[model samples]
Target: MPRRPISPQLLARQALALLIGYASARVALWLYLPLPWMLGPMFGCTVAALAGAPISGPNQLRMIVIPIIGVLLGSAITLPVLLSMPGWWPAFLVLAPFLLAALAGSYVVFRRLGGFDRSTAFFSAMPGGLNDAMLLGAAAGGDERRIALAHATRILVVVFLIPLFFSLVYGATGSAGGGNPARNVALSALSLSDWAILTAAAALGYWGGKKLDLPAYAVMGPMIVSGAAHVAGIVHVAPPTQLVNLAQLVIGVVIGCRFLGTTFREVSREMAVAGASAAVMIVIALAFAVPVAAIMQMPATQAFLAFSPGGLAEMSLLALSMGEDLAFVSVMHLTRIALVVAMARPIWRWVARRGEKDGA
Candidate 1:
């Protein structure tokens, strides 16, 4: 008998299945997991994709673009707080080593895993801007899809495990009152004027980042512009609630889209190795962060988020919700991004050369 043709209805059902798979994973993580929101969505996407969903499409741009914008908006929250501080330069000096070690350690883990190259493992494991990492991966000729999946898996594992670990080890202390200690910001609500200012900042930041080729345009751009706006007193208000929700939704949807057609069949032994490498990368990062967290006198969960080889938004979100040092996580995450970007080319080359020598 001739095989029946795949109808539009079937395609639609498949699409919905993909979406549901991803969404369910995310909702579970968002509700139950201890990780950040940004990480949850990516985790959902990977799970959905692994479950035979069709998230990966011809338009890869959407997968990469939205997260960039979302990250910018999220990171913008830090700008006003950071600018108000004294001796920002000195702060950077203190953070530089930790970030470098995180990135370098990631590379070492990647090299140790034989099937993949340094670029793939490094970009996959490097915790920073998700959008920036994807772009960097593409530029370095690393597999964007694999990197995306690896990133998603790391996020999922951390999100699912970290909170439980803390609760089991440290005991659940209710919602962690994580935020900047110095900032007298209000999260109850925001005025219309504040919303307008934030919107303008996001728009202008998007424009400027595209023009200047900044890393993680959406988050970074909006952050810089909005921060400047606050510093200049043009937008002297906190971020609005509606804008925050919108940013979360967009980021969640985009991250979820990646899980379109994932399944166990698709997860090859090599991919498993890559995932293990990513997990290893996270462990190494955690080890490096313990001393720093102790020196800084931060809580264990806060230290884990700060040092975990997870994305910036994910770690910061976890920190903020758990009532840890949001600013500290933000600064640490930014430092990691800057360090990775600065050293990406050399790292990529090193990985590539190493892979060749190893006949990978």
Candidate 2:
């Protein structure tokens, strides 16, 4: 179980890619754009990778970077953030139907239009759980590689583009992790003891997350711990803006490197199908947000953020950046992940069995 030696050339390539991405993010931030730290780095490395750069991301770097993101997200929560949870219960009612609709729309695009195999189409149509989708798809005799790539593309596209939509809606009044107009941000203002306590929380939380097998535990564990500490009034500090931006940049590079080994011709059709499915899900989320938001007496923006088809970490960070309700956003995304895990695998197996019987 010893780790393989990483090539120095690979490390150098990754560094160059990150430098390009980070530089690009700085320029974008200077221009006062939304999600500048993440968006620019992601797309910057994506272009470099697509143009046939022999580059891979430093996964170890992301492991460190992602947890910082978790800490930042956690600090957003306070007693007040948890107090706002009761108002968000109604939004969960909209999630089940929204999920069904997303599955149906994705099925149509992947199956009928794209001509993917039934199993691939079915599992790929699912709106969440990339790891589960890929594994279940493979177990059902579908193309696991295609499923993985499809999801990687879907998540990358969703996280990368959704912010722009928000930007146009919310305007650029807010900024990244530092000087947040919203309370509960900026790790730099903390004292030495505060840092010690927060980092201690992070380490313990990570251990607990791993023990519990939480999705994206590195981020989630620290987040839960940090949020708890803040809610308990144990600490008032958040992760520093410099640290937050660095985390975002490295994460952007990780996402961008997802495209490194594949050619456009190979993944283009799958990407198209996946992107279409994601686009359909986005529409469905937005469509459901309006009436639900009215009924729930919440902002349409809040509803949309809850329903958005992005990862928990990315969306939570997005909500934080735009000065939206982070607690509701984080919880809904967590619920969505749970829903997908409990439902997607069994549903795929049933469909796969049904397809086999029909084909006979």
Candidate 3:
């Protein structure tokens, strides 16, 4: 099937949204906010959207930017980081239990407090896999709109709060790997050969990952390919800081634009429910993160980012911005999403059957 053509009006809206995002980023930088390029755009676009602006998500642009982020993340995976993977078993071991606890706690909050139906509450309570939850929830006779809104609200709240928490509590700022002056190279610093390698990795990785149907393939594919090249010592430079910041701006805009067509009346109740559920999940995440950090002998922020119920891309970006272990955080989020995708439906089905039996 051929792709549909985008309308000029839609293009105009997208441009306007990007302009707002960029302007917001500059203001945020002037004010010295943490992760200004991202958070600034996110806040600006969200406010615009809620005010009934004709904003549309730059989905096509975001696809292009995602590969850039993937390459940036891949550059963090050095040979020693790859070798240290074995020691992360404890964190990995706790992920399943942590997910279960988050799901159960959130389910209770959604059902009891939010008054959501069983299917809606259960799927809305998922710790990850937003798309999956919406699809499955709709198929299971839940309200699709509610499920989507709940998940979107969860991502927005989690992404917005995590960085602030780190900045305020831990004094961590977003400097792209803790202000590593060496990593702040401009685009002009890259050799032509380096550009070719990076370009090939982004293109080939995206192609291969899509062919294999990997989750979050746009980002994951490039990350894997770039990571391999980095580990092999084939590439010695990261993408330019300017490009990375642009990528962040685009991603923030995409996330905030999710609310474009929503009204406060339509989403107020659902947002409240999802926000409360997100809080429950965050507490559970911290509960697990503290102990896991001790056992893994890493910063608590790293573990928290790994265990947070935020989207894979969002959490990984936070890790990258905060100078945390991007490799570990990305892997853990991949695992969480994969687990939710594989297990949520079967678990929900079992619960449904039990409910049926009890009622009968």
Candidate 4:
């Protein structure tokens, strides 16, 4: 069956919804500077959506912006960043068990407390992006909507809570929040040649990534291409802050829109479960991050973000702002995503089938 072209009315609705989401995020920036735009709209849209508002999230816009995000991620991968990685070996050794522990622990929270079905709970508890969780879970017959909401709430909680903990508990004082908060490049500094190369990388990398069937290929593909460019010293700067923020705005809108028809009662009920699951993972991550930091003789702040189950790009950017090692954090995030994507589906399927057999 052929998929019908999107209707103009629906497109318009989506646009309006995104505008609302973007506005909400902008307002949120007053409270939290680091991820104000993304987090704010995400919360607002979830509320508006659950209330049965006519607005929608920015899914269509995300397809375009994700590539730009990939390009930004790529620009962070300089040759010097690569050389600064030998000290990270200890943490990498611990990442495997950390992934499994987080997954297993969260799965129990969803299944037992949230009352999710086997497949939905399994995928819901995964620490991957909302898009990845939904696609993977739906492929294995999980409730797509439930999985989407679960993952969305997970990200919202994790991103917000991690920073708050740092600020309130640790008394960390940084001008810009997260990773190595670098100076921003004015949009005016970008030359035509710069535009040409970046656009080409995004375009080509997205196409190639899709062809290769890679996870988050649009972002990862360009990351590879752009990372190569910067590593080779062909480019020295990331995408402009203006553009990167735009990417975040659209992505947040899309995430918020995923809850368009869910009721507030339902979202609230599940959110409690999601929040608990995320909290559990945070506790576990913190426990491991300390030892890993001590063993590696690195800062605790850097190790925490590296182990944190936030989005790869979000965590990387946070690391950048917090004045941490961007390359090391990026590498850790990439490793976590790859490991989750590779293992999540197969493990869930095995568990689902086993449960079915036991019931029969």
Return the TM-score for each candidate structure: 0.71, 0.92, 0.95, 0.90
lDDT of 2 by residue, 1-360 (tens): 999988899889988988888887887778776677777787888878878887788789887677777777777788877887776767887788888888888888888878888888888887878777888788878898878777777778787667777767755344743225545445568799888877887788888998999866787898899888888888887877777778778877877887887878777877887888888888988998888889988778888888888777677767777777777788788788888878786766777688789982
Candidate 1 stretches with Cα past 4 Å from truth are 1-45, 54-100, 103-105, 108-114, 117-125, 129-145, 172-188, 232-237, 268-271, 350-360
Give the number of colliding residue pairs in candidate 3: 0
Return the top candidate by lDDT: 3
C-alpha local distance difference test of each model:
0.57, 0.78, 0.87, 0.79
Worst 10 residues of 2 by lDDT: 171-180
lDDT string for model 1 (1-360, tens) is 986776677656545544554465356544654432344445555556566654443223333344333433343455556655453343345455655565665555555764556567678766555666788888888888777776666555565456666679777532312223233245555577766676777677778877997765545666677667666666655553333333443354455554455566765654566556556656665676666566656566776766665556555555655667655666666666767677766766786787799996
**lDDT ranking, best first:** 3, 4, 2, 1
Candidate 4 regions with alpha-carbon error over 4 angstroms = 1-5, 129-132, 173-181, 349-360
TM-score of predicted structure 4: 0.90
> Model 3: per-residue lDDT, tens digit, 1-360?
999999999999999999999998888888767677888898899889988898888999999988987898788889999889899999889899999999999999999999998999999999998878988999999898888888888988998888888888888777632223446768898999999999998999899989998878888899899999999999989888888888889988988898878877877887888999999999999999999999878899889999999988778878877777788998888888888888897899898998799892
Order the candidates by TM-score, highest first — what do you get?
3, 2, 4, 1
As a TM-score, model 2 comes out at 0.92
Q: Give the TM-score of candidate 1.
A: 0.71
- Please give the lDDT score at residue 312 for candidate 1: 60
